[model samples]
Target: MSPARVGRVAVLAAALGALAGAGAGWWVDPGGDGTRPALPATAAAGRPSSFAGADASWRGASPGLDAAHAAPSDLAARRTGAPRGAVGTPELQALLRAPPSALRASLKTAMRHRDQGGWLYARALARQCVLLEMTTLHEGTAGLAPVDLNQPLAQRVSAWREQLAAGCAQLQPEELREAMNVPAAASGTSATPGTLDGADPLIQLMDRPAPPGSAAARERLAAILNRADPLMLSELGPALLQREGEAFVFDGRRLAGEDERRALEAATMLLPCALGLACDERDERVWGPCVMTGDCRHATREEAVLAATDADAGLDAGPAAPDRRAAVRAWVERLREAVLARDVDRFLRPPG
Candidate 1:
């Protein structure tokens, strides 16, 4: 086949395989957590052992998962019906977009290309077998209630590590060494330190189910999102509409100032409007539940203000304290006006 055809074939196969697994509730977790307690340790391998060791082994499993015939047959014979709403669909793709900040972007990218043969495998397996471990965690949490939107992002990171270790266990030392690129002197060192930049997407896809007839293609479909910054979801989704049901009123109209403008501009840089702002001691931090989502929101506002002031001051000592404080006070007033008016646009517009 032509190169283009070959590439299309790979994509098609990967999609089918992934879809099939989603339907069957099968995932590959590279972490050695044994997501499938009933299945044999080497079931994912699905073939004879190529090698074995504490940290590495190779099961000559067929890369072609044959989801069309195999997946449905196995799913039917299992006897246990799927959970209340267990129909498999492409859900992971929805999560590919970036979240709150650059850190989340970095993680999304890193997870996309993780080695499925390692820790990524375990995570996938666990998700596939249990189907609800992570899902439940997400749905169980309060706020941002999108079935599994509340899932702790930190837990996903932990699961990624687990998947990596488990997949690594099935490889031989030489294979592990080669996969991790560990030199003789650096036997125990991790080769993935900086390589995470390239591995994120692979990990993301692998963690999801492999589409039918595309196991081999899915395994080989390795495309790196080389861009330094991936797409941010906050920028793509619906705009944040204020729910306060009030408006800012100045002399004759709504009260608004440069501070409100700057604050709105700053809002774009933040996560869901659901994480509003709160007064933390003397500083304004992201709004949480207690002190503000007290846990997640930090001195983000203070930090931003400091950064803006420092940038404005340049090398100078900055204007007198009273002058700076006056500016902040004015900003506070504008913010109040903007919030009351629910002028999300004016709020986000940068102050001159």
Candidate 2:
């Protein structure tokens, strides 16, 4: 076989292998039987989860569970300023315990690619911690009324900011880039046009912004995205570096290999939600009468960079509301159905 043919075979084999593993994993849902949930009657609607009442402090950058006691008074306090002799506080002690220490170590590893953006790293760390927090909160409040989403979000945000300031203050661009070994120059090289630039009927309808003066109406947009199932990027490995060719279909045309397809899908599935979350959280916590665009908000220079990429890529620029999370959740159920029914077509489409 030619090198291209070999490459194609390798890609197909890898995808099939991965699909098998994923299939097995889903089949053995340790938590519950692998029954997928039903889709809702109507897709959730509206602007990015309305910042008017959304919790700003719940963003991914807020300090992990440690921020509560690390700086009891001000979530922005430097690590050096933490209560020097009061390390005995239960929360502080808990933060020092093996679990949080393990979490910290895990963070260092996860942040190995820090140069991508400190804010990005910070946001990721905060999100993981919040998920942990939310999980714990749910367990603790089993059978309780609705969570005090506002308070937890505020506390999480405060803690996240403090932790980010303390942990990331010394991270200069060059040092971060060197640590991650991602060439700062290479970020400029990817040449694929974004999703909306193509001819997909669904995407085309999603290309434009929501109608004007719909800020309040669009508030739930972010939450809608947030509630979506997260895309597992590992599925696209074999296709990453392959050349775009007639065999590869993306947007509407045959592009290249799996890499671009994966990128396009991610932009379609995740970018918009990330942007909506960032915007909604920022509006709820930082600004007043904020518009949808980043320019109308108070993001730091770093966050501004992230926001711009999402907006410019048009990944996050879909119809103002699609219950993206719900879509993903429903997709998960469909996957379960496919696996049970042995439906090959349901499992083989280009992701998103």
Best by lDDT: 2
Model 1, runs deviating above 4 Å: 1-300, 315-317, 343-352
Tens-digit per-residue lDDT, 1-352, candidate 2:
5454344333333333323422212112232432211111111111222212223332334232433433222112223321122111122212221123233432444343232222222223333333222222334343323323245434444444344334433333333332223222322222321232222211111222333224421332222222221111111212211123434332234545433343333333222222222222222212111111112232321232223234434455366223433433333233223322433333222334
Worst 10 residues of 1 by lDDT: 46-55
TM-score of each: 0.20, 0.26
Model 1 global lDDT (CA atoms, 0 to 1): 0.26
lDDT of 1 at 218: 24
lDDT of 2: 0.28
Clashing residue pairs in all predictions, respectively, total: 72, 25
lDDT of each: 0.26, 0.28
> How many angstroms is residue 280 displaced in model 2 relative to the true structure, after the best TM-score fit?
13
TM-score of the candidate numbered 1? 0.20
- Model 1 lDDT per residue over 94-124, tens place: 1211121111222223233233212222223
